[model samples]
Target: MAKRQVQTTKIDGKRVRIVTTTGANGTRVQVTEAEPKEWELQAAQVRALRGMPEYGKQFLLAGDQNSAKRGPRAQMEASAAGMTPGEADMRIYIAGGQLRMIENKVGRGRLSPAQVDRHAALARMGFTVDVLRAVTTEDAAHQAVALVRGWLAENDNQSGQGQPRCSSTACA
Candidate 1:
């Protein structure tokens, strides 16, 4: 059996409400799964990228689908419906001359249906699209840095999945 509970606690000095799940064995499957706002997650990711200028720069607003939602005439009606949903958050330029797109999600966030379809289309077009999930907003920067660090350490151009390990932990 599984049990679920909603609770509020402090994370990195900020109070957050989280939902947790426990498995049949009474072991916690998820701990403090704080659902940070999309903007908050994006900002944290940008901070991570900016701090590691050698690896990545801040996310470009022009390329960020999430950011564009705040601009004037954000929704394009049917005019932008051909490509499925919005694009990934970051178009990371690998030093090895490869490109990988990253979609950031915090906690248990997921991509929308249209985004999933778009991801499939991009894959068919030989584009490497991956979602980078962080366990918590407090550690989102660390997780993002780990991802870029892995990308930087990798010199192989053969495959995007064979990412090099910058340290013991790899981003999920």
Candidate 2:
């Protein structure tokens, strides 16, 4: 039997757990990469989102506040009073002060009521909230990268440029 609680390293978008058992044959080690918990999956998505281009862009954390950071009484009120949830996952700022929201969700995940409200509010403010879906965090990360590129191109095209001019050899 292996301990299901210990997480070792993360691969792709999921954290891996390693276990070791000792028997008459000395020592045996096993690695278990099983079902991912919601937080773990969400964390994987965050990591992927951070991999987007580093040029003229900044990443900022969003969503729920850490419970540990709140006082005991504060936690009680926050849960009871129904604190309004912030934007999901992350907020990225591009060169021209454009802000966008990015969230990664698995098929089984659902947004809470507060989250839904927050998203609606953000949309009304002219911010595009992109929720990416994929089978794995790794796949979602690739989508994030593509999205960043698209946003850059969109801004460029809207700035009186006919079309995006790619300086890379691939475009040439």
Candidate 3:
């Protein structure tokens, strides 16, 4: 028997670990399971935010295969199909007038380099971007609502209009 060897590598910029062992049968290789990525967790939070009657219909999931699980081949195909990098996770409409983008993050999760670049591009195009992070889903939701309300108010003020009102069906 020979001592086991361990090493780390990166796939798609995410860290992965590999181990190799030698025996009478030659060498065997094993890869450790990667930790759950933040996208799914953040997606669940997005769903929760959308489920709320107050703001549910105002948001739509954006970006590539938001809730779908994909393998390497699928990812390659998506890229080949012209998927844009760093798209915001959610698109939100406020007061039926303003369009905004929301990027959701979970524990210690930060935007990737591509995301940072995309955000800048979108901002240059005069888009509103918001990042939400909180200790709890409820807190995030409240913060999002407050941000939207403030945006609506500011837009109204700039347009020389009074405060915008919310309707039963939409945030008008």
Candidate 4:
């Protein structure tokens, strides 16, 4: 029989559990969190930024609702409805007629395997994808806002001629 061991550690000021079990073959470890505190904080910050009048354009939520607690039936329904795993948290339409995807992470959080695959796929399709991490800090948040503001400024300049420059092939 294998004995299970659990230990607590602080992640971004939140308590997380790391479990380990030793079996005849080897030892296995797992990490879990009581709640995604960091992610939630980052999401709130992102929403605040999105709500700003300067950046209040059309931004769509790409993540699934109640995804973590979804049952098999719900999963099936989502799949049928064309919901994909690892979709970016938000999709924004830039002024220059470009579509951008944003994925938010906080602290030392890294992208899941599915996210990595999806990012690669999107990149291959010529879409711009950006991962915004560590946004819980004011400095990081400000930097992100500045980056988006810069993009908006450039986009505004490009479309200053009354007719917006379309980046899509069908624009002609």
Indicate which candidate wins on TM-score.
4
Q: What is the lDDT of residue 91 in candidate 3?
A: 70
TM-score, cand. 1 = 0.58
Q: How close is candidate 2 to the true structure, as a TM-score?
A: 0.55
Stretches of model 3 off by over 4 angstroms after superposition: 1-69, 80-82, 95-97, 159-172
RMSD of 2: 9.8
**lDDT by residue for model 4 over 1-172, one digit each (tens)?**
9989988898797778899999998999998874444446445647666766765352222333222457899888888988777777666666445676667666667888888888899999998667776634564456556656666677667667424456677446
Error of 2 at 13 (Å): 14
Question: lDDT by residue for model 2 over 2-42, one digit each (tens)?
Answer: 33334478778766777766656666677877545444445
TM-scores of the candidates in the order shown: 0.58, 0.55, 0.53, 0.62
Model 1 poorest 10 in a row by lDDT: 55-64
Clashes of each: 0, 0, 0, 0
Give lDDT for model 3: 0.65
lDDT of 2: 0.62
Model 4 TM-score is 0.62
Give lDDT per model, in order. Answer: 0.63, 0.62, 0.65, 0.65
Candidate 1 residue 57 C-alpha distance from true site, Å: 9.4
